[model samples]
Target: MRLFLKFIVVGFLNTVISYILFIAFLSILNYQASYTLSYCLSIGISYLLNTKIVFNVNRSIKSFLRFPLVYLVQYIFGFIILYLLNQYTKIENHIGILIVIFLSIPLTFILSRVVLLKKIQ
Candidate 1:
């Protein structure tokens, strides 16, 4: 529970940063492009926070390399959801992104735990 809470906190911070970057980039880029750039940039921050703060694990080159797998999964699902919402529904890009972020939290936490805590043999 505590670990989950920490993940939530870190996720919240990450989301804020991503959202801000998305909005900033929206001025010059398409929504999808903005989202992709922001999401990719935020992955590094998410990895550091998840490893050191949420999971209390030391950062390693190996873990860092593996970390983005979690976000890649999240990004695929998130992009699908975002596309569906934007195309089929009346939801705006900004609101659709919020929905995607909320839905992704649990899956993100689980994947991050598996990747970050697994014993590498």
Candidate 2:
């Protein structure tokens, strides 16, 4: 129960950070980087928070290498999805952002459970 709560809190923080960065880059900066900037920034923050806060992952050689690898793959998939949605949808940017947020729930949970939270063998 505690772990689940921790995950939710961390996940919520990550979502806010990612969404803010996405909007700022896409709307304000007018940087048509196509989500790359947001993905890089948010993924880094999410990995850091998830490792230290949510998982209490101790810094170790194996874990360090593996954790980032898992995050990279997950972020790639997430970026692709977000990009495709932005391209294909008629939804407003704000609504599209919200849609992406909901869409991320299962992917986030699965990746966090199966990869990030999995016991390192």
lDDT leader = 1
Over the full model, what C-alpha lDDT does candidate 2 score relative to the true structure?
0.67
Error (Å) of candidate 1 at residue 3 is: 0.3
Off by over 4 Å in 2: 28-34
Per-residue accuracy of model 1 over 1-121 as CA lDDT, tens digit each? 8889998999999999999999899899998999899999999999988888999989999999999999999999999999999999999988999999999998998899999999422
Worst 10 residues of 1 by lDDT: 112-121
- Residue 12 in candidate 2, Cα distance off native in Å: 0.9
Q: lDDT values of the candidates?
A: 0.92, 0.67
Q: What is the TM-score of each predicted model, taking all chains together? A: 0.96, 0.73
TM-score between model 1 and native: 0.96
Candidate 2 clashing pairs, residues 3+ apart or interchain: none
Write model 2 residue lDDT over 18-54, tens digit each, in one string. Answer: 7778877877554336356776677668777877887
Residue 53's C-alpha lDDT in candidate 1? 93
